[model samples]
Target: MARQVISPGWKVVIGSGIGISFGAAPIFTSGFALLTSAMAHEYGWNQTEVAQAATIVLSATMIAYLFCAWPLDRLGSRRFAATSIALFAISLVVLSQVGPSLSQFYLAAALFGFVGAGTNVVSYAKAISRWFDRKRGLALGLAASAQAGGSFIVPLAAHGIITRYGWSAALLSFAAFEIVVCLPLVAWLVKDSPPADASVPDSGSRPQIAEPEVAEADIGAAEIVRSATFWKLALCFAAIGMSFYAIAPNTMYILTRRGDVTAADVAWIQAIGAIAALFGRILVGLLLDRLHARVVGILTVLLMATSMLINGTATGVATMAAASILMGFAIGGEADLMPYLAGRYFGTRSVSKVFSWLLFAFCIGAAAGPVAFVRLSTLSDSVVTPLLLLSALQIVPVALFLSLGRYRTAPEPAFNLAAAPS
Candidate 1:
């Protein structure tokens, strides 16, 4: 049989990728850090205070993920994603209106975190997986690159807008953009798989529709938690997250603190990192499809740790820029690995739920990372100790992954075998 050309499934992959990027950018690391700096300067809030709000947002998101998994699976990806985008846009507007009230800022961030749960990696991972089975790693990486892409544009835009019209106006504009641009695409393009009953197996490299029986074999959140493999994967990701997130919120501050680099320089450096991240996501995605994920994971962890060490000791612009690139590359692979692994090891039926648990660990790391860095900085009156400590701590995940032997592989019944349509 001749191979079929491309399929419409690629549209879903493309749309969800852009949607996730749009939904995540404003509140994610790069954009959020710029906003934090603006708010801190305007309100006289310290680094710890600004970082604490982020911690609150992440912690709330972590909790919300626990409940969102079922809703994501049940409500369908389109509705869930649309709602998440709307809520996120509203939250951005509220954040803009947070003019003299720290309480309002924190409240809005926490709300964003809660509603933003559906916009996380889990939202699109299963949906994309349903569309493409053969190169699922690359598909997920493509989706994740949206986040990297957003990081590039949003932070640069946020910084420029804040510089011109003030932070409030910047946020309002972002909200407007998200509603007008992102929501429509998500509504039009993002969707769950067609019912398995009438599914057709596509020729060529098109993803085969999964068998209902195979999907049904997937365990629930309760069952996943009971398994030892689940916790190991969870903890491993948490450690990676902790190390990377420690630098994310502080990158601008660290680069500019010594007066060697200006705000514009920081923006450019972050943009560079974002670009590197996009490539990293795509590259790792391709690699994961063919290579042992554990090996890929270890390399990513090493890059992250090395970046931390460089950032901790760097005194020049070139060194700081190099550190940023390394960090970005590591993060690109790191974010894609967990979700890909979860669905690979577990079953697709419960991908949203299983990955949600992993996302909770991600959120914990994100929440703890910034505060811990800021607290250590304040206590020690320097950034050195925190960076070094985080760099050293990367070992936890490295060790955990090294021992993640059987967990990375599929269970007794191979899910990969069931990935193709009957």
Candidate 2:
């Protein structure tokens, strides 16, 4: 692909998008599950409650993201995200002050979940998709990888901080970190569209100007809502949320079941997994640009299935490490692909709103994953088996993606920057 026209404004969008991805990642992912032993030990909470809270957090996130979707496009990504970021920072601090009460913990988790829901990869993906098409997947992937990078940094940092400092101190530090990291960047650069995005270039020397495109008929969203592509993508993405979040929230839980896996080994596995995700995200981003989105998606899903199978059949320390890394590959790829595919099919006009709705579907899957896994595991007294079954569930998304190949995005003429803007 030719070098992407990354003007100064576009660069800022990518940076802020990365911040959004990173700051938003830690709240709902395996962070709690990884730190479960430390949290439970400190707060004197039971296993069931702790596990249940993970589900609640995902549930809260699902609902919040749904609520934020269309409003975000209308309210503006920057404004919507700003409020959510503030909520996340404050929630973390308040959560640290939480006592042993289940209700309090649940409330904290809900706030955290809600904040995370509003500020996520979808927003970042939409912002980038508006600016670049040729390299859209790569840009989206790199921004998406910020979340994976956060998954790496936050857990390790939390583990060390909680081990050294108390949970309250560590949490205060976490909140402070989010405020410092997300606020200034988002406030500065998170615009809804590029200056040229909504305008057309004039033929010769006519000066160009930014204008929000208006379509005739003002097509009611309900009409778009009823399309076959919509439901297929929604269901597929939701399935993705299920399989991915299930593993994310349960990695440490599954590891803890065994007595011999050392902290050093777990740390190494997690670090390796995080590192792998960065590459995986970048690879999918690159691939999505050059290759067929759904074909690449199918391959990535298969790779993820293999990873899940490895996770299911785990015996000792080595297999666990490999599984974590393999699973990371899937998470990273899908993280990149979802938004890229959205752009490939839907275009930038309503990308944020579309992705927001898709993410709501994703949230439903995400919420069900960890909580259901925990519940079923408790009921059946089996962890690995229940999780392994989720692999089969992922196949449905692969089929849905295949069906999606027929849905093509409009060929919006690329903004020829050298030409006069109109």
Candidate 3:
């Protein structure tokens, strides 16, 4: 038997995974939880105040996603990724050096968000969309699993370093990893697209099934903005970002408040959640390829709602652990769905810009969710109230997603180029 060959597309997936594994999202979502308590204690700041850093990061990130869309298409992924990763490393270093002032920390968070935008899903998804049409969902799933991998590892590593050395040391180590490891790997393996002649499967390779070639239509920004489907997607994702993401940063706090779970237990629970997320992404991708995307999306949202309800009512370690697993799985599914839906509905011609607008909506929800959660907790003096409310809000996305109807099918040059927004 002959050896099976890997495609350049798969190589781009590998590079995308590695870059994302060490990118800003994981560090913010996982590592920052560990940092929040540590920084709050060290500086005599409230946990809520420290947690505002996430809001700052998301606010800046939305702006960056909007501005970077044109540049990402112009410069291409390789050059754009390299520059952003380098700047992201510097921002991490700056974060590691923050003094007593909360303002200083917030500024660093802003820089972290703005410069690190390229390292997020926008660029990687854009690149992966160019390469694999038949397997785009699975390709994106494999790439996104890296975020779960990072989430699983970052908390453990950061917890260890914070316990032994300090929070700053852990951040500095992350910066070094981005510089020494992520930078070189991304620069070497990532490309904008496959060779022009290599769209078909190689000779002697297993025959791949063909899917609807929506990217052929190549819808532009002007067409996308005018479409009703676009707004539905934006609303769906924004609600997803708000209702689901509210749980991530506050996981440790929620568990600790129970007074029975230890710090190590919390870490292990998060790790288990991340593992579930890893599988969830891959499984959802397979399902998306085989089934209707809206059906899969509705199921994912139900899973998220269930997780929130479990978390709100959890009284024991086992229940909390179960809640975490469900939460992670839903988060993973949403991550995969966002790009998959973007490519499917709008096509790839202006996917990055279109995705940027959707992501901007997501960032808006993300920035507001935690603050809303915290405020509700303070007002009602109960975490359960806010969590249950968020769980109910999942209905909004489920309804919106169902209304997306069918994917667009149009001939090539579907929209006039001259009318596209600058």
Number of backbone collisions per candidate: 0, 1, 0
Models ranked on lDDT: 3, 1, 2
TM-score of each: 0.92, 0.88, 0.92
Window of ten residues with lowest summed lDDT in model 1: 198-207
Model 3, residue pairs in steric clash: none
The number of clashing residue pairs in model 2 is 1
lDDT of 3: 0.81
lDDT of each: 0.78, 0.70, 0.81
The sequence of per-residue lDDT tens digits that candidate 2 reaches over residues 101-127 is 889888988887887776677656655
> Judged by lDDT against the true structure, how good is candidate 1?
0.78
Model 3 is weakest, by summed lDDT over 10 consecutive residues, at 200-209
lDDT of candidate 3 over 263-329, digit per residue (tens)? 6788788888888888898888888777778999998899999998998888898998898889888
Q: Residue-wise lDDT of candidate 1 within 1-422, one digit each (tens)? A: 65435355666778888787867532577788888888889889987888888788888888988887888878878888888889888888887888668888889888878887777677787777666554678888888888888888888898889999998998899889889998999888776874454333223332344543354565766887888778888898888767777778777767776348877788888888888898999989998877778878888889988988988888888888898899888989966897777877776676787888898888888889878888888898888888888888888888877876544334223244446468
Which candidate ranks first by lDDT, i.e. highest?
3
TM-score of 2: 0.88
